[model samples]
Target chain A: MTHKSLITSLIVSGWLALVLVGGCSIKTRALLFDGVDKEPPPPTTRVRRDLLAEIETLKRDLADAQKALETAKAKQQVKTADAPLPTELAKSWVELSELLPKHRSGQVDWGAALQAGTIRPQAGLDPTVLAYAEFNLDITLDRTKSPTMAARGLSAVKFSHAAHSQWLICDNCHTKGFQINNNGTDNILKHDYCDNCHGTVAFAMANLDTCDRCHLRLP
Target chain B: MPAFSPLLFALLFITTVANAAPEVMGNITYQRQGEQVADGTPAAIFPHWVHRVRYKCYVCHFEIYQMQAGSDKASMQDIIAGKSCGVCHNGKIAWNIKFDTCSRCHRAEE
Candidate 1:
C-alpha cells in the first residue's frame, strides 16, 4: 500500500477506536442506573405496606375509643335515671324539726292542733295563698309554745297535700314572714335559721337564696 | 399570594369585633378578710353574669347576700361545694372547683 494511504487508514482506525470506547462507557452508565432503579422497589414496597398497616391500626384504635365512649355515656344515663327526687325542702324540714310537741311550755302555743281551712286573700294569691294558709295554721297552733314544739308540729303535717305541710313549711320558713316587720323578709328568715341550726342538727341553710318559689315579691 | 382567603379574613374580623368585653356590665370585687376557711389573701372579681343565670336577685340581694354591696363577707371556700358558687357550680352541673380553675372565678384585682 502507498505511505499516504497507510497514514489515512491509521487515523481512521484511531477515530473508530475512540467512538467505540465512548459507546461502551455510555452503555456502562446505563447499566449502573438500571441496577440502582431495581434497588428502590423493595424499600418502596415495604414503606407502602407499613403505611397500610398504620392505617389499619389507627382505624382499630378509633373504633375502640368510640365503643368506650358509648359505654360510659350509657352508664351515666342509667345512673341519672335511677337517682331519687331532689327533695331539698323535705331534707331541710327533717333536719330542722322532726319531733312533735307532746306538751306546751313556751311563748308559742305548739299544743294547738292545726285546723283545716282555706287560705286568706292576698296579693298574688295563686302563689302565696297556699303558703299563707300553712304558715297561719302553724303559727296559730304553736302560738304559745317553744321553737322546738312549733317546728315539731309544723313538720308533723303531711307533705303529700299541696295545701298542707308543703305549703306551710315553704311559707313559714322558706318564704317571707307573715308580718310587715323588717325581720319578716326572706333574707332575715334564712339568716336567723342558719344562725340557730348551722352545724347543730340541720344542714347549713346559709346558701338558700331562692325564695321566690314562695314569696311573691322580689325582695 | 393573597394575604388571607376571603372567608378566613371575614371570620377573623367578626371574631375580633364580637369578643370585646361588655361595656355596661358592672364589676364585682370580693375581699377575703378571713371569712373563708381556705386561702384568704386576695379578693375575687366575680362576674355578675355567672350568678344571674342560675339564681334570681332575691337569692343573694335580700337573702343570702345582703342588700348592701360590701356587706357580704363570703370566702373562696364558702362556695366550693354548695355554699356560694357551689350552689350551682358543683362539679355535677357546673365547673369543678380547683386550684387550676381559680382564675375563672376569682381574680386578685380587676
Candidate 2:
C-alpha cells in the first residue's frame, strides 16, 4: 500500500473505533442508571428460597388485612349514610326544605308540612347547611370588625364555608376551629390558625398582595 | 454509507449527552405485586443489585420488563413462553420451572 493511503486507512480505523466505544459507553451508562431515582436502603432478608416463601405468606396476610380495613370503611360509610342528624330541628328543617319543593310551594309550617306527606328525608345532612348551622350562630360579634376585615388591621377575608366543606370533614374543624356556639371572639380565621394546614400540608396561604383570592369587596 | 451514517450519528449523539452519576444499588430488594399472583403467593422480592451486576438495563427494560414499578405483570405462562424472569430461568439458560424449586421464585413459606 502507498504511504499516504496507509495513513488514511489508519485514520478511518481510529474513527470507527471511537464511534463504537462511544456508543457502547452510553448504552452501558444508561442501563446501569435508569429507573434508579434515589439511593435505596439495603435489603434486610436474604433473597433465599425459604425466606422468599415466608415473605410471600406475609404479603398475602397483609393483603387480607388491607381488604378487611377497606370493608370496614365501606360499612362505616353505609352506617353514616343511614343515621339521622343530631338535632330534631336540623332533621325537620332539611325534611321541610325537600317537601316544600316537591309538595307545597307556600308557607311551610315544618311539622304540618312534614305530616301532610311522606317525609323524603334529606340524603344525610347537606354540607353547606351543616356549615351554616354550625358557624352562622345568631350571636353577633360585639367587637365585630367590618366585612372588609383588612381595613380593621386584619386580613380582608370573605369566608366560604361551602367551598371549604367540599374537602374538609365537619369534625375536622367544627368545635375544634371555633365553637359549636361560636361567640366570634376566637382568632381562628387568622394566619396562625389557617396556616396550620394551609402552608404546611395544603396549598400555602401566601402572597398577601393577591387579596382577591380570599377577600372580595362586597358591593 | 447510508446505514453507516445513521450509526455514526447515533454514536455521536449518545456520547454528546451529559453523563449522570452512576447508580448505587443501595436497597436491593424490590417487592413485586403479590395480589396479581394467583394461588395467594407472596409478592416476589427481586434482588435488583444482584441482577444489575450481571446484566445491562436494556436487556430487560423496554424489552422483557418496563421501567416503572407495578407495570410488568410476569405470569407463569409468559415465563414459560420465554418471557420476563423466564427468559433466563426457562431451564435452557438457568433453572427450569420444576415443582421442587417452585419456592425459589413463588416463595410460599407459611
Candidate 3:
C-alpha cells in the first residue's frame, strides 16, 4: 500500500478507538458518580404522623369541654336566679370556642374542645340527617401558601364532617355539591355553595344562627 | 539517535497511574427521623464518611440498614439498647450514649 494510504488508515482507526473509549468513559462516569457531590436527600416531611395520638387527645379534650359548656348553658334559663358558671367550666368554654379556629390555623390546640350544645345529636331529626348535622371539621382557607398555609389563616371554618361523612361519601359532595374546579372555587364560606344544601335539606345558610354553627369566627 | 519507545513507555506509565489512582469516596449525609417527634427537636444528620472510614460496607449495610431511605426507624431508645447505631456507637466501641452526647448525632442545636 502507498505511505499516504497507510497514514490515513492509522488516523481513521485512532479516531474510531478514541470515540468508542470516550463514549464508554462518559457513561461510566455518569452512572458511578451521578450523586457523588450532590447534597443528600432531604428528610421526609411527615403528614399527620401523630394522627392517632392527636385523635385520642382530641377525644379527651372534647369530653372535658362538653361537660364545662353544659354546666354553663344549664343556667341560661334561670336568668333571675343568676347561677354563676363554674370557673373551670367558663375557662373551658372560652377555650373550646377558640379551639377549632386555632387548629384550622395550624396551631395544634389539643386541649381545646367543642361547646356542649354545639355537637348534640338531634333526637327529632332522622339518623341520616343527624349524621350530616354532627359532621364538624376545621378547614383553613389559606390555599396559596401550601405546606405553611395552616400557619397563616386569611379565613377558616369548622365544617361539620360528622354531619356529612356518615351520610355521604367523598364523591357525593366532592364534585357534585361543589364544583371540582380546584383552581380557586373551594371557599366554603360562600353563601351560594353552602346554601345549595343548607337551605334545601339542612338548616338555612343565612348570616343568622345557622352561620355561627359552621363559621366559628362569628361573635 | 535515541529510540522513541522510552518516551512512549513514559507516557503510557503516566496514563496508567492516572487511571489506576484510588477513587476518593464522597461525603454522604443521612437525615434520621423520630428524633424530632420524641423531643420536638430537629432530625439527626449522620455523616457517613466518619463511620465508613473505619468499618467495611457489609458491617452495617444489610444487617443494620436495608439500604432504603427512611426504612430504618432507629429511635433513641433502640440506640441505647445496643441496636442499629448502638452496634458500634455503644460505650464499648465508639462514643458512649450514657454521657448524654445526643448532640453528637441529633441536631440538638436546631
For each candidate, what TM-score against the reference?
0.25, 0.23, 0.23
Write the number of the candidate with greater lDDT, choosing between 2 and 3: 3
The lDDT per prediction is 0.43, 0.48, 0.48
Q: How much does each candidate deviate from the true structure in C-alpha RMSD?
A: 23.8, 40.4, 40.5
Sorted into a CAPRI-style docking class, model 2 comes out as: incorrect
Residue A85, model 1: Cα distance from true site in angstroms: 28
Error of 3 at A93 (Å): 55
- lDDT tens per residue, model 2, A1-219: 699999999999999977865676545645656754444455654446668899999999999999999999999998976564332223223342443322122322223323343222231223223211323312223224443343355444565554444333354445443233333434444543444344432334344433444445421
RMSD of 1: 23.8
Compare candidates 1 and 3 on TM-score and give the better one: 1
Expressed as tens digits, the lDDT of each residue in A111-200 for candidate 3 is 231232222222221223322233456454333523332434423455555545433444445554345333453444354355444443
Model 3, residue B83: distance off in Å is 0.7
Identify the superior model by TM-score, candidate 1 or candidate 2.
1
C-alpha-based local distance difference test score of model 3 = 0.48
